[model samples]
Each structure stands twice: as C-alpha cells, then as structure tokens.
Target: MRRSVPMQRLDGLVDPRQGLGAAEAQARSARYGLNVIIPGVRSGWRTTLADTLRDPMLWFLLATGALFMLIGSYTEALIMLLALVPLFGMDAYLHRRTQASVEGLSGRLATTARVLRDGSQRTVPAETLVPGDLVLVRSGEFFPADGLIVAGEELQVDESTLTGEAWPVRKQVVEQGLFSHIRETAVEDVYWGMAGTRQLTGHAWLRVTLTGAETLYGEVVRSAVAGPHAQTPLQRSVAHLVKVLIVAAIVFCLALAWLRYHQGHGLVDALLSALTLAIAALPEEFPVVLTFFLGVGVYRLARRRALVRRSLVVESIGRVSCVCSDKTGTLTEGRLRLTHLLPMSNISEQRLQTLAAAASQADSGDPLDEAVLSNCPPPVEQHILARFPFTEDRRKATMVSEQEDGLLVAVKGAPEVVLGLCELPEAERRDWLAAVEAYSNDGHKVIGCAYRTLTSEAWTGANQIGG
Candidate 1:
C-alpha cells in the first residue's frame, strides 16, 4: 500500500541493499498475520445445503407436498415432506467430504523463501515475509507474496490460475518512479509479480508490496472458494429434465380432470381426484436415486485427495472421454529432456547443439530452449548481435552472432521451415524430409537446427541483414 518504491524509503522500512533487518521483519510479520486465505468459514456446509434445497427436483417435490396440504391432506403432505430428511443429510455429508480434501491444499504456505536481510540473502519461511521484504524468485519456484519487479532476466510466469490462459507471461523491469503498475490491471504491468504464480524462466528481484487477501492471487482464490459457483453441465441437464416432467404431469392431470367433469362428476371432486392421481404418478424415487449416486462419487474422489467443488459435477467429470489440453499440449513434470539428436553430415552432435543454443534466448523460460541449453553450451566466443524472435507465422527463431571469421546465422524451428532456410542438394533435402517424417511417426517432437555464414553484401543495417 506504500507509494514509495524500495530505494527512496530506505530510512524507515526497507534498505535498498539489505531489505528489512531481521528484527524489523519480525515486527512487520506480527503486524500482518500469516499469509493464508480461509474460505471455509463462508463456503462450508451451509452453502452446500442451500444449493441442494434450490435444486429443481427438490423444489418440485416440495411444491407437490405444499399442494397436498392446500387440499386438506395434512397427513399425506407431512409424510411427503418428511421424506426430504435423508436427502439433505446425505448432501451435507458429501459436501464435507469434498471440502476436507482441498482444505490442506488451499491453505498450504510456502515453506522457504530467499530474501535479502542485513544486506545478505537469507533463506526463511515464506509465511514470515512482510510487505517491505525484498525477495528473489528463480526458475521453477512459486512467488511467496505479491510484489513489483525491479530487475530480472528474461522472466516468464504461468498466470493460468488467474487468467485461465495456458501461455507464459513475460515480465519487464519497472523503471524508477513508475508507480502506475501497482493498481493497473494491464497485462503489460510487467512490474507486478503476484503471489502463488510459478516463475517459469528467470531470476527476479521484487520488493514485496502485498500479502494474504490483498494480493491478486489471494483475491481470486477467496472469490472462487467462497462464492456461489456457476451452473455446471450436469446441473443444467437435470433442471431441464425436471421442467419437462413437471409440464407432462400438469397436462395429464388437466385431461383427467376434464374427462371426469364430462362424465357428470362434481367439479371440485373431479379436480381433487385428478390432482391426487398426478401426485401419485410422479416418480418419487428419482431425487433419491440421483443424489445417492453422486454422493458415492464424492466419497470416492475425496479418498483419492481430489475434490469437486460441487458434488453434481462428479457426474460431469465421469462423462469426459477425450480431454484435449490447452495450447501448450500435455502437462509434464516441469522439465524437458533432449532425447535424441540427428545432425547433418557436415556437423557433429555438439556443433548442432551449440547452434541451437545460440539461436535460443538464454533462460527465456521456453522448454525447447532450456532443453537445448542443457544439452550443450552456446559457442563461448560468439554472441548474438541481432535477433528475430519466433512467432506463429515465423515458426522459427533466428539469431545473428558475431564470430571471428564472420557473422554466423543460427536458426532453429519446425523442420519444414528450417529446411527451407538451408541451401542443400535436392537429393539430400528429400532424404532429410523422409527422415523427419519417420522421426515424427515415432512420437518425437523434432526441432530443426541450422547455421549459415553471412555474405559480404549482407553487411548493412541490423534489421536489414539476412538471418
């Protein structure tokens, strides 16, 4: 909440180089409690019970019982209403099961954090972090609290939890005196680093600004956990079925009542008789059966440490056959391994890996680049002088590196695109194309690597030079 950036306010709270002293941090931690969001107080059994009573099937059953009471069938109405007892009890039990499974996961706090204290980096418990703490987060680590990025490498983060998007977001350093990033919601607010988001690719230095409910990630979790969830597919289907059944019951009852009146029966007597028959014809076991089945699913899922926010959603999840993942493809163990390398006859395996690494952004947070860097270090004597980043249309990344002899152009990307960039004999090209096809058939994610020398005529403006 403080408007002062980390450096200017060194006298009171944070020292630019040392962050907060150990004693000062402890006092601040006491002022702001542990960074945990507890939504169970509002979203527990009461909310689930309310949702169950509002269900279409239960609503219809209650309405029918109330109609029986209007017709002076007190004993029958009471019996029908009493039947709801087990339904409510069973729903409550299932709600507890699902809630218990996720409680530990939702309330989990990061056990360790790397922070600057007394002018030296110290590893401490994440929950002890306060607003003024200067934190350093690296690749594959979750941020402990919300803060503003002061400096970092090619930092990228997975913000899918907040945006429901599957792509990595690149973060930029905040220039001095630019305070607009604190409240602004733009994706370009590269200075903002929210708590709980995983840092995908770089070392970042951030000054902690907010924690607990005040942080963006914490707010999202609070709303999702405590508030009413949107209707799921199964809920909609059951409601539609209930509506159709209610309409049919009304139509059949009206016809029966009309026929009775036509046969000279008294109007009131005929109407009462029709209503009774309609009530009896209704399937009283329908609600009981459906609720019982979903309850079983909730119990089973809870045993495996999985929780469905709504019990009815258990049925929806069961119906899934082929689930296509988001644009990033299937999720893995947060790493990638370079399993194979097939190089050209003119190049060795290390040479091929070196060229691929030269084309990649160092610590760019891209899995492909990380895999290549792990395989071989980039040529030590060469460094990129110009870069053309990859895009959907480009399907490749190209870098021009200054070498001792000349400028070396290194490229890596989809095989078809990379092959077009290389000047090879037609026969060799065809043979390589066949090889690519065979490799793809074996389920390998192949990337093409190539290098070429810049011509004397290509020496011109940076952007105008050929890749």
Candidate 2:
C-alpha cells in the first residue's frame, strides 16, 4: 500500500531555526557554490595521453608521425610531434576554460530557500527542503525552491526568462488547492525555472515539492552546461581535408614502397621512406590557426550584441541570404506613442480637453491607452456611465459619461476598426485610409479615436459613437 503525504500549509514567513543557523546556511551555500559541480583536478599523464589519442586531428597527426618513425625519418617525426603537442594543448586549454566559466556561473545562483518549518518559519537550504516544507516567495525574488502556490493575491510573475514569453503571467491559488488536471505528475501549480519566470507582484507561500536538479532552474543549468560546443566551419573544412590527406598519404606510401622495392631497395628501407613522406604532409598547425579565427569572430559578434553560442554559427551568419524579422521590439520601440490629434468637428481647446479627458480615463492600462492618457488633460470632475476595457480582438474601448451640457461618449481603438464604424465623408475616408496604409507600409502601428454627443432621452448603450 502507498503511504499518503500530508499537504503542508504555504502561508506566512518562516523564522530562522536553530538547526539552520546563519553559519550553517552560509557553509552549505559555500559548499554547493550556487549548486554546481566544481571542475575536478586535471587528469594525469595516462588520461592526457588517452584524450590526445582520441582527438581526430591528433589521431591523424599520430598516424602520420608513426609512419615517419617506421620509415627511419627522425627529423620529420620530431617536427610532427612538436606541431601536434601544441595543438592538443590549445584544445585542452579551451575546453577547460569553457567548463570553468560555466561552473562559475552555476556557483553564482541561489541553492536554498527560506521556509516555514515546525510551526515556526526558518531558513532552510534548498537541499534540506522536504517534500512538504512551506517556503515563502516574495516579489522581485527568484524561486530557489519549487512548490505549489497555497496562498496568494494579485500575483503577477515574469516567467519570460524561463518560457521566452514577453508578458507577465498572473497566478492564483486554484480552488482545488492543487492543480490535478495538469499532465505532469509533479505538482501542477508549482512553476519550473525552465520557464524563466520570476515573481513580479504580491507574496505567497509554497510547499517545497522539488529541490536540487529536480527543480526547473536545475534543468536550465543542466541544458546550459551540457550543451554541445559548436565547431567553426573552417575547423570542419580542415578536418575533412585532414581525412582526405591521411588517405592520400597511405596511398602514396604504398606506391613509394612498391617502386623502391622494384628498384632493388630493401622492403623495410622503402617502407621507412614512405612513412617519412606521410608525416611531412600532415598539417598539425591547422588547429591553432582555426582557434585564432574563431576567437576573433566571437569578439566581433559580441560587440554587435549577439552572443556566439556556437563558434560555427558566426560563419553561418555570413552565408544567410534573406532575413525574416519581427516588427515589434526588433524594428520599433514596441511601445505606442501619441503623435497626432484629429477632431471631426471644429472645437475649442476646452471642448477637446473634455473629450480627451473622458477617453483617457476610460483606458485600460495598455500601451495605446497610456499614450492617449499622456496626451489628454485630466478631467475636472465627472462620473462614468459605462466603461469597457480595450481588447485586441475588439480593437476598441468605449465609454459613456455625463458632461456639463449633456451625455457624451468616447471611443478609441485600431484606426481601421474605428473607421469602419464611423460615418465619415467618402473622399476624406479614402484619404485617411491611404495615409494609414502609407504609415503601415512604413512600419508604423496606428490607432484611431472618435467621439459623439448624446441626448438624455436617446442615450443608450448601443448608441455610443466610434471612429
């Protein structure tokens, strides 16, 4: 029979407990060093020899050098060995440096969480968090421990780091207290670090459900650390060239040995001469040259705000023919700004202010709404009859309110949507459409606004005007 685990309450802050003193927490964190495996000591001679032999370039060079040695060509063998050793060393150094950098990054991350324990709140290193330990999460904080949200209000989380989403996601405690319908067997309500999310607003307590490598951040770290190193295009081309050269050397040696033997020379001496020729043909300095090229390319790309994940991708960028780009954030600022105001009928600044104020107050905190409110003057004192939030699908916001003279209505949304609802002159509408099209083709996102007056008797929800 399976034993049932009790659901832990995730509320309030955990106090520091005796077992988890500051000294212990610091020591634990130090030991984990941001929860990453530190690079161990370098391998000794035997391991180093094994690694060198395993390298493709080193293997090619070794085969060539062995052939030279067999052919009794000491000078060529020495030259090949000298060239191969430095290349092997460069490769080892680069690999170790990359590994060390990743380890250092991992060490900078938080490894534990402060949680409520034993009816008193206490700081617990994430490794010590039990399956049901209550952990507190605050705004502007990274979730060091993974758990289900048990209590929270008005919480917005920026999960873009983990999910690549550009907007904040609102989180709430589900009525069931646990998200059972989610496909993952793990706690459903608990967020993972792979989603790259962080709390934006409000505070809540979570019961520690997963820790260490099992957490979302752990997965991200694993992926980042385990990602394959990209090889440069030149390196690949050189490797291919080396393979062909090795085959050619083998053929040339065989042919030379046959010719020398036919000309009455000893088979052994002929074989030795053939081996020397093979070693001389091998280009062991190619790797060092390739490394220098890759390093230079990476530095140049970094200056352009592009991080070269794979050294080879730098070369690929040069070969790209056509580019498909996103309009938002890539080309434009992505934030809407007020540019112009067009009144349908001639009105004084005071009347325009009255209309702009009513429209601005009805805005629903969007970029366009913020722009409109910024351009409009504040209302003096007025009550709203009805207000509707702007919806991207509807592309409009409508508000009905009472004015000093009579009832008035204001509307704002995408220019095309407002224009379709307006009864403007045909010629003027065509000109406006042409201007809008021109702006759109020039990559400007446009919005339109309209207003109408209403009599008390005819003031109905459906009668609100728009343009």
Candidate 3:
C-alpha cells in the first residue's frame, strides 16, 4: 500500500468538495470490480465433483479399475466403479447444502452506504462504492469502505471486530500540512475508518482509498479462504494411514506381477491377477466402521447434555484443555439492579431517592434511571416547572421541580459534567471526585446527581439556563 499523502496533495487527485462525478465513478467501478469480499470460491456440484476426483483413495481405485478394463477383466472393473457411487453422492450433497446455507446468510449482512456522487450526497448499496468516493459515516452506522479522514468531529469508532481493541478510538480530522513530512502522523491516525468497524460517536467524511476485497476487512476474509481447510488431528492421521495402505498395496501388486511373469504367464494376465489382489488388499468397510463408531460417540455425548455439531470432533474431544469467554452476559447475569446510593449532603438516603425520582423521567429509556425510579416513591404535590432533555452536546439532563417549600433544580449526568455545575466547597468537591473515580475504577457506571435550591426569580429564568 502507498503511504498516506497530505490532504492538499490528495485534493489534486480527487475533488474533496464535490467528490467523483457519476461518469468517472461508473468507469472506475467497472475497472476495480464490485466492492464485495469473496472469501472463497463458491462451492457447487461441479467443484464438489472435482474435489472428489482429487482424493488419493479415489485415484488409486480409478487406476486399478483402468488396469482391470485394459486386461478385459470386466467383472472386476464394474465392481471398482460401483464402489465410488455412495462416496461421490455423499460428498456432492454435503457441499451443495453448505454452499446454499452460506449464500443465504450473506444476504442478511448487506448494508446501504451514504456517498457523494455527482457533487450530491446520496445513499446507495455499499457494494457500489468505489475508490476516491467521499463517504459519510455517523453513530450507529458501520463504515462502508476503508478510507482516510478528510473531516470529522468527535468521531469515535469501535474497532473491536478488527483489532480486538475493546475501547473506542477517538478520530480527529487532520489539518493542512499535517502529513507534509509523512513521518509525523501515524498511519492509523491518518486513515479514517475500516469496513466492519462501527462508528460509536460523532460524524466523519472519508476519502475512499480501498474497497471490495482489497479492503483490510476484506483481506481478513480472503485470508480465511486461502487458509487450509479445518481438519482434526485424528482425521489427518487417518488420511495419512489410508495413503500408506494404498502405497503398500501398489508395492505388493508389483511384486505379485513380477512373480507371475516369471511363472510363464502372459504380461496382461499377470497384471490382471495383480490388480485383483490389489482390490482385495484395501478394506472397503473402513469408512463405514469409522462412521459407526463416531455416530455412537455423538449419541453418547448428546445423552450427557453435550451437543456435537460434527462427528469428526468426537475423536478430538479429549484434547480440550481450556475454554475462554467474554465476561459480559457469560460470567455474569448482566441484569442491572440498584446496588448503592451516595449522598453528598447531610440528607438521608430516603430524601436522595425522592429527589432523584422526582427529577427522573417516568418513561425514560435508560436502564439505570429505571432502576432508580423503581426504588423510590414519587414526590407529593411536586410539579415539573421546566425540563432539559439529554443531548450528545450537553452530556447531562436537568429538571426544575416546584414543591411546597421552594423550586429545586436537579442535575444528573457524567460525574465530571455534574461536578462542574455543583457549588460544593473545595474540600467537599475533592471527596466527591475521589468517590467518582473509585466507583469508575471498580467497573461501575456512575451517574452523578446534584441539586440546588431555586428562588422564584431563578425558576423564571430557568429557560435561559437550559433547565
């Protein structure tokens, strides 16, 4: 891959303001091919049949049958040909079923992408995207293609699927001359996003550099296709053993042929007799015996509440040493419950609960808020005076409630944001911040809550302060 160039240099190659025109895009799409990843050649009856013909055992059988036919041994040739009927049928059926199942699944993951075409923004199929296209990505949307970040704001991406990085990466737009030297900026920071990664926050416009099977994620898929087929150690051993047996049978046949020729028999007759001996040398029921034992093992495992997906795995069951899994929803129940309550003031826990409940939205779609409201009773005779809905920019929610005593303004949000709005003393403020850090470090999601007493004048001006 070429090193990332400066945006100014890139601007000369493709228009950053208008992007590629429709005519040029169509021409390039035809040249570059569709933006689709072909992990492996699609399996079909023809490929399955070809693969069956490539097997070593099948080759041995075919050679033996040919020699028999050449010597006019009609009955032996027919028997050898008939032996392959069941094997070929089984191989073709399995391959066709697996291929159809994979093709059906690929349909569910196809996505629509937003791109700039003909100097206008439009949504199109992700596979239609080409190089040099300007693509827009937003929160909750997966990246359409691999590209460089031309412009962005607070853009954070979850690359867990690609890099196994659990935390979201914050992406920033590079200014002019940032890549002038090429050695200053990191490659990852220069490139915008990759396909299959999700945009977790903010928005960005990327100049598509690679698409289709050439993309990073596409390369991963391609590598899987180019990789060796999965096989158990036992299966590999059995295959090797079969090859050895076939070679030994061929050697014994040649020796028998030599002895018959010395006994004054014709060359054709000697070869025919050797071929018959080779046919008897192989165990025709080997596959059936192995299949029967594996099937019985699978049944036994099923009776013990263990589901085995493939019979080949039965032989490798004793090799399992360790199992790893994600902690969320696997090691834990993953259900939220009210665990602890912290009140910064001298107020009792009951007072805090009532205050939080009064400020909480009854139908709030947040699980934490739901847990809080469920543990507290509604405030008596309290009416909502003003409300400020939560937004990405604010990172907080505010509510003004009017009670018999006075009007109260409640704030609940990120610990840092809420702490900034509170009027606590310096010493008390440090304590609150320390508590917040402690909870955060313990892997607990903390929501800071604070309130202030508001007079009539303040309540009237609530709208100005975004209450």
Which candidate leads the pack in lDDT?
1
lDDT (10s digit) by residue, model 1, range 1-467: 22233333223433334488889888877887765543344456669788687766677668778878877889878876876775677677766755664465454335578999878999988877887888999877778877778777667776655555545677777764454333333334467787767787678887777777777777766665666656667667666776777788888889999989999998997899788877777665566567668777877887886656677678878888997764432354444679998997778887888888999876555667778888786777776678776655567788888887887888888888888877788999999999999989986778888877875467563533232
Positional deviation of residue 13's Cα in model 1 after best superposition, in angstroms: 6.6
Q: Please say which candidate is ahead in TM-score: 1 or 3.
A: 3
Report the candidate with higher lDDT, 1 versus 3.
1
Candidates ranked by TM-score: 3, 2, 1
Q: Which ranges of candidate 2 are over 4 A from the true structure?
A: 1-54, 61-109, 164-167, 177-196, 228-238, 261-272, 280-292, 302-306, 321-467
Question: TM-score, each model?
Answer: 0.51, 0.52, 0.63
Report how far off residue 30 is in candidate 1 (Å).
Answer: 4.1
Ranking by lDDT: 1, 3, 2
When summed lDDT is taken over every stretch of 10 residues in candidate 3, the lowest stretch is 1-10
Candidate 3: where is the Cα deviation over 4 Å?
Answer: 1-16, 38-43, 57-110, 165-167, 179-186, 230-240, 254-276, 283-467
- Compute the lDDT of residue 193 as modeled in candidate 1: 80
**Ten residues in sequence with the least summed lDDT for candidate 1:** 1-10
Error of 2 at 412 (Å): 20
lDDT of 2 by residue, 206-310 (tens): 644455565566677677656665555666889888778778878987899899988989987787777666666666567546645655666687678664544
- TM-score, candidate 1, is 0.51
